[model samples]
Target: MISGRRQKKLGVRTLDIAKRLLDYGFHPPTIYFPLNVEECMMIEPTETESKETLDEFIEAMIQIAKEAEENPEIVQEAPHTTVVKRLDETKAARKPVLRYRKREAQKQ
Candidate 1:
């Protein structure tokens, strides 16, 4: 288990990295948990995982770090390849749109 803390100077949050992981064909790590640590990302790799898989994840992480430094905006607006794009999490949680409302016919 490896827990990484975000570097605020890098101008990227763990959530951004988590979303970006989808584009790299990986699931996002646990972020901002444990309460004590700020912007913590917890990664737990099982022994069942092969060396190649671990290497790929390492490479992906390195690449993401580089992207975070060079192109923070891209990292900030992530999950470009996912089925659904980034959402307003606060809005979704606060003002959820549960049902769809159809428009009535307008008068000509």
Candidate 2:
């Protein structure tokens, strides 16, 4: 297990990533993501030095960040995962839909 300043340095990376993602239109990759309390963006690169796994995951994460910066289409298309994805969530968020299409018009 990585201890001391290294771990602390790594720990702050979550925030760093979030702040960096701000440049893009989307929010910081969902701050404390997943809603599982501590089960968030706590990637322990120090814990794993398997080279391939580390390189691959880190590289992908980097590419995701870059993609977020350059073309957000990739980030938005993060598919084949769970229920929260693969749909136009914005459409579901329309309050008119929530209120059964009761638009504020013609009502006296």
Candidate 3:
């Protein structure tokens, strides 16, 4: 349960996060909006990096998964490895920023 202000703050934080994701060489993961549901974040390093990079990514993912399972808080505190920080995900969705142009603009 959060207010619009808190949600906006989280949204800004998430936006900052999404920006860094762009540097990953792959697009950022899809973010839902105006709908309220738990979000899923994913990263398939193969989509963006070389074999060596992907291997490093896989290793990190494996380690992260293990740590997250061992202590869920670790993952919750993740995105830390990233430029972004953990946030109330629900807030992220209620408000979002679109990377692509507006649908109407695209159709024009």
Candidate 4:
């Protein structure tokens, strides 16, 4: 269980870190809330993951931590390699878009 804490007034968002994990070919753990903990990352490794995979995940986390320390911006703005970037959670929650709507050109 990794709990991220804000340091020196620099905001460290657990959500951002989780999103960054996607860039590393790993799924982020469930974070924050429920436990009333701040920036909590609950890591539960399944038997399916091989030793190599676990090693890679550890490496990615170490790299992310380093980035957070040196260049916090990188960690702050994550998922740079994904097909879609960040989302507007507030807007999405307020106005949910469940289904996809194809463009007129695509309908042709």
How would you encode candidate 1's per-residue C-alpha lDDT over 1-108 as one tens digit per residue?
333454357888888888888999988988878777777788887889899998999998889888988898888999999889999999999999898666675432
Q: Can you give the lDDT of residue 20 in candidate 2?
A: 37
The segments of candidate 3 whose C-alpha lies over 4 angstroms from its true place after superposition are: 1-48, 81-84, 95-108
Question: What lDDT score goes with residue 22 in model 2?
Answer: 39
Tens-place lDDT per residue, model 2, 1-40, is 1111221233433444444333332233444454554424
* Cα lDDT tens digits for candidate 4, 1-108: 887775224675888789889999898888885477767889889999899999999999888888888888887888888999988889989998898899999999
Ranking by TM-score: 4, 1, 3, 2
Give per-residue CA lDDT, model 3, range 77-107, as digits (tens): 4455445555565877887655866688688
Off by over 4 Å in 4: 6-9, 100-108
Backbone clash numbers for all candidates listed: 0, 0, 0, 0
Which residue pairs does candidate 2 place in steric collision?
none
Candidate 1 regions exceeding 4 Å error are 1-6, 97-108
What TM-score number comes out for model 2?
0.37
